[model samples]
Target: METDNKESIIDYQYKALKDGKSIRLLYLHTSSSYHQLPIEVSLCEFPIDACPSFGALSYAWSIDDDPAPSDRELLCDGASIKITKNCEAALKRLRRPKQDQILWVDAVCINQADLEERSLQVRLMRQIYTQASWVALWVGDASTAVDEESGLPLSDLGMDFIHDFAVEIAERTNSGQALNEGPLYQEFIKDRRAFQYSESEVFAPRVRGVWDVFHRNWWKRLWVIQEVALATDPTLLCGLKAETFHNLKIVIKALIRSEQPVDVMEFNSLFIAHTFHQFHVRHMIETGTMGKISPPGIKALDILNATRNTQASDPRDKIYGILGFFGPPATDTENIFPDPDYTKPAAELYADVSRAIILNTKNLDVLSSCYGFFKSTVPDLPSWVASWNDTPVQYFDGKIFNAAGSSTVVYEDCGDKLLMRIKGRHVDSVKLAGQIPDSIGYSNEACIELWRYWWKFASTLDSYPTGETVTDVFKDTLCWGSHLDYSRQQLGENKESFNAWLEILTGTDDTDIAAKRIFNDGEPFKYAHRATSVTWGRNMSITNKGYLAMVPIITKADDKIVIFQGSKLPFIVRTEDGTSKLGGPCYVRGMMDGEFATEEDAGAMDELEWFTLK
Candidate 1:
């Protein structure tokens, strides 16, 4: 890449974590290598297990035993990394010296070389950096550090919006006292049945009701649900029409001088994230945030119309307005990558396999190695994500939108590796975690056709095998925010019959046959252990999991509300223990039970069998 311009060298060793454990990382001051095309850094012949206490004091490597030799470590694929001029100044800076440096990027590491290996590393990534002597977080929260005014990464941050908004709202307005008790009150209490609430009542002030009329968890709902509305008119955001705006002005002012504020940022990030997530969520809803118009997201052109009716003070803009504050969209995780279109039929069935593998920075070194294989073999990925001129570790799956306003990613464990079936366009998928599919071993053609189904499906929002339409998917999962990236995973209905149908549709054999046998004729999808079941006209089963999208979300009797229905997946009946078992998320009202998408797609399910990482 670029030649070293700084006169000083950053030779360091033996870094220790807060827990006082020795950690190994090639922490060289490659500040001078910014934007340089290609450069090399000498790594010891093998990975170092332990780092030294202090680096650059003197010659560290034993010259007699070194195999890489000086200046012969590993060559970086792109960019020269710049370090801070002073230790304090550099404390927050993140730089990638080279792609192939003994240690390069946490995002691109393909650590799951084996199933056991993957299991061991995922749980450790959270610890490795959290305990690092000093984790050089990039400009974003993923690896280096969270940044300000940066584009939001779709993978992890979006979830923060839904979960945080839910938690925040749940903390407020969850009481049986009902929000309509009076005009919007400044303080509120938790409802015993709230998502995260416990027997002990949790209360807090600074909360407001969704409306003076309903008094729902307006503020507590995913920020995305109301962000667009708020953005249109922040004033409306505070009343019965909208929800409470935890402007956080009071708390922020209080934190002006406290160290706890920085730590507190993590807890409030959901608010920041809802700014964007809310937009994606509402964009798909038919209700249109009260009076706002909804845009049919068929093409990129829809964005223009969406903007026209966009609430003036929309939270989406507010979230993006402070983009740089969260650092980069992704940190240690592979925050950027190719996205499959989730709007189609094939993707509805085949599932997003390649995406599931690269979820987190389980093992930086290992994941990076897997990325190398992708660049070498796949050869053609999206231009922005190409290997040569890119940041290491920049891809993730988990963005899919159903018409009724729902989104989520599906993950499947394919033996040694985790397959994240995603909704994308160009590159269907790229496997990671040191584990490659045996199916991939056969021929790239199988992989190509497999992805072709996904590609065509996501490219268009029709024919999703769900026996439900985009509108149906959106209704149940409206709170789930699906961004433009089309990243998605684990699609077929979670029930066993649909799993079998997915196998037939994808041209992939059913690896889970024992599960297939559970479903009998006269059942939905004619397969097993399903808790719900339904059939269309003429004795035909609607549980085909063939990716044929459900149709006619508009009810014949009315247009304002969709006609509700049920599926044959399994029994929602309660056990003797008084608990109900079901797969996927559902809405239970008195005796009215229906399977639908959640506002946010965090893979909500009533039981382990209902959802599978595999």
Candidate 2:
């Protein structure tokens, strides 16, 4: 009987969801030890809006490219199935020892093999999670290694430090010892008497714990942004220990406010998590509105851009996962695409999303976000489509430029879904392109050498087309015509800062001396980093019309610069096969602000030239 049962090969089959609003919940049986007990669960269906009290699991499906083996078998009802090591770990940790634990685990609840069912289930995720009693954010296992110096678990030390840091902040704020709450003005908290740890003291283990906590795989997942944001209450689970999401958020906010020692956007998972918590969730909860007044409301394009650097198992989830934040597409007019259709290819879905955003926003500002034109992984993706896969080197301010004036996108679809046609005015063609530095923000000498090379190249031009001195145009072009401060004002009156930074970079004999000086004087390095960062993945190019401009790294001499009807900035387009392929967006000195298209000509749609993008 045992041999017959073993050879039976029982397979778990999912019954179709009763309706569009229906979802599955798993009842995980109790276990004393994960190693000793077989993981068993039973699935039941219910309407999401009226489902029984259950905790939702929000976790990373796979931690890395070569994830641990999925050799563990899960018993569901009378059948056995395979589950990812990460998912299995989460379930094992989540299972209660006393009684059955009900959960809405996506991997177990949803029938992933069925594409139609997957799409429907994805659409209902917002409801599923929002209605759940609590959200368990499983951030993998806690480190068991004890810090020899501190005599504490490495991961626990990190959480304790964060809690203590928050306590210090509250005590200081209440006592009126407020510090400047900005990344630039990070004055150290000298009052370490409470924590009894000094900046110079032997507290390396504590710092390591802080880094480990923030750099978890769970924080970087794309779906967690919505999962945690929409959850009524969220509990961050790491192996046996747990903490509230609110506390974790306080830690992140405190770091941003007065404690970040490094680039939070680079080292810490700042933008996606912070933006979702402080901006998206806060606005909705405070105002009872879907959008915000100061930073604008939740828009599809904005959401996509915010989470572009986040990871997803399916390329399509890059868009689908974010849809739950706003209203449903069938009802909300602002929603870009229809329901999440897994049947569509990723390239096709991305292209369609691009078109929908352009049409919905009535502007080609989305085109400026298209970094995928050159390096997209999606095969046969349209040049006009933004892949939303990776973050752009620098984000162009949507309100800064209006090369095409106050005009809306004039889209002309020629019955072919893949082909996109738009109208634009020919601005200029590239004449001479200067090489961008191979290494930026690393070596002071390399940046100085490259800047000097650029200055020498600028000297070759007889005169500036914008009527400004070549010196001024060249300086402004390096930072893309805007001041690099928090205000982001135009670079017209900030020449002294640029000159002062350059003097420090060039006036020194040793690069080490320059580096030390810049480090000592923070303002100078701020200017230098901003200048180099914007021009890192780009080059300075002299236009055929004798304009100093910034173009893509792939740009060459004779590449056409064109301003689309609704584009805030001009784009570099390379003509091939009688069609245009976008080289990427550019900054043409003197042509950024409605200089190419006058108000009168821009309004006259018939006067513009139309080009098709393949």
Candidate 3:
């Protein structure tokens, strides 16, 4: 087909994927123009068994507007069609100057206006990217030349550090040295004085710059996870520079090892750094690059939990986006994968996914993610499933060590609905719930003051007459094996250990004179700093029966703390108007093991009920 008095272009038509059919991809013709390039879009069918070679585009859409027409236009089948500036730029950068590039640019390839076609195309997203010869990650336009002072563009100086760091890591990897053995580590050991005294002067600014790049919106997108993870070969595009995913992994690994000087940076930067660290670690595990240490296979719930912070335009994509990583569906009995349908509401989608995971895995561990319902705007969701569409509940697992231990939860069918069946005893009901206190300021003096306050509080609490010492009970309440164990190692087994735990909580231990003069710097202040920051947001509550527990910040008085059978930690639940709401998970004293289920505690058990969480 041709337009009147215009150059003839390949006319692409939309064809749905039939039972034994292939997907049609947009073949973008090459363009040489640097400005206002008119892309030529043609349709090419890629068979399931013999897919044509193509490069897929992975990108975050522009925030200024929807997929509206811009001044630039693309020639689609001899007809002019307006394209977004973002798409225009992506096409210009992706298109080769001399050769035709067969690409699967989702915006152009799928008839997005047609809801049915969009749903069909989304289901095949995994195939589109995985089958492609390469995947180009468009991180906006190319960056300008590296700046002389910081050796990177001022706006993205962190990229330069990351790139340099990645190069060093690649060198070490190629030389057969472990990734942990590198110049960064050597410098860290050899130049302790420089890092200790000149941290702000030398490393603070550089670290901040690198962190800025990671906080970019592209890193937090939900869909890119599947896009990049499923690709055969992925290339990262930043401005004009190009880097492979392998090199990017190296940079991430290097950053994970290079301890950031948290004392000098802002709290948000520290949090972001920690988040990126976890993100990279999870990515490594998921992509099977973490070697034998990786899990046998990741559960869909785990993926959703790990990437819950990742943003998605449609909430349902939060689950749908990561489906590719779980591998294809198995038999009819194992078909837990939720079909991609844009028509479903976010709550319905979340509920269905939760149900499938529970029925297929036959475990209630998925419900372990449930937390108190503060206030949800999403309509028609049971209190059981988390608001997967909303902002993720910030559960500070880093502070509580034993939180990672395995737990067994069985699922049961209760007449018309599903229910989690577990064994355990009720601990206490919340009597007083306190809001998270104001942050202990970031300064050294402020941290020390906070430490002193906590120390005094601990001493006073220890003086109280109780069966178990206040310190022991409090440590157990925090689920000690993780963060508390580290504190115990730092502080001796005596009274000093109690003070050491306080110091760890306040981020003030390293500031001591004795520790400052020696090479043995106390744990990186960031750990304590994060612990303190996270503590500020947690709800401190006293049980009606005089028990103390730290629940999620959203928890309120009347929430019941129950140690469910097989759960590693206790959970908080709130019952109102004949409906029970799960208040997420928590750690309680004497509940880590099955101690609560023992016959000795039989009399302490509150009544057990078949609680149905809708």
Runs of candidate 3 exceeding 4 Å displacement: 1-20, 63-73, 80-83, 143-164, 172-213, 258-298, 332-335, 376-380, 394-424, 435-466, 475-481, 484-527, 533-536, 598-607
lDDT of all predictions: 0.25, 0.72, 0.57
**Per-residue error at 293 for model 1, in Å?**
42
Q: Write down the TM-score of every candidate.
A: 0.22, 0.88, 0.75
Give model 3 RMSD, 1 decimal: 6.6
Poorest lDDT segment (10 consecutive residues) of candidate 1: 532-541
RMSD to native for every prediction? Answer: 24.0, 4.8, 6.6
Top lDDT hit: 2
- Scored by TM-score, the top model is 2
- lDDT of candidate 3 over 137-159, digit per residue (tens): 87666344344675665335555
Better of 1 and 3 by lDDT: 3
lDDT of 1 by residue, 1-614 (tens): 44455444343221123232222344333545444422333322212235432121001121112221233222322322332122112221233443222332221121212333322233333233223332221111221212133443321332233234444434444553422232222122122123122321132212211111112122222212322332322211111112222332222222222333222332233223323333443334334432222221111112212232222122222212221111122442222221222232222211222232223311111111122212322223321111221222222211122222222322344442222222211101111111123333322233333323432433354544445554334222211211112233232333354444334434543434322332223232332111111111001012223222211111111111111111111111111232211111111111112233223323533212222122
The alpha-carbon lDDT assigned to residue 211 of candidate 3 equals 44
Task: Return the candidate ranking by lDDT, descending.
Answer: 2, 3, 1
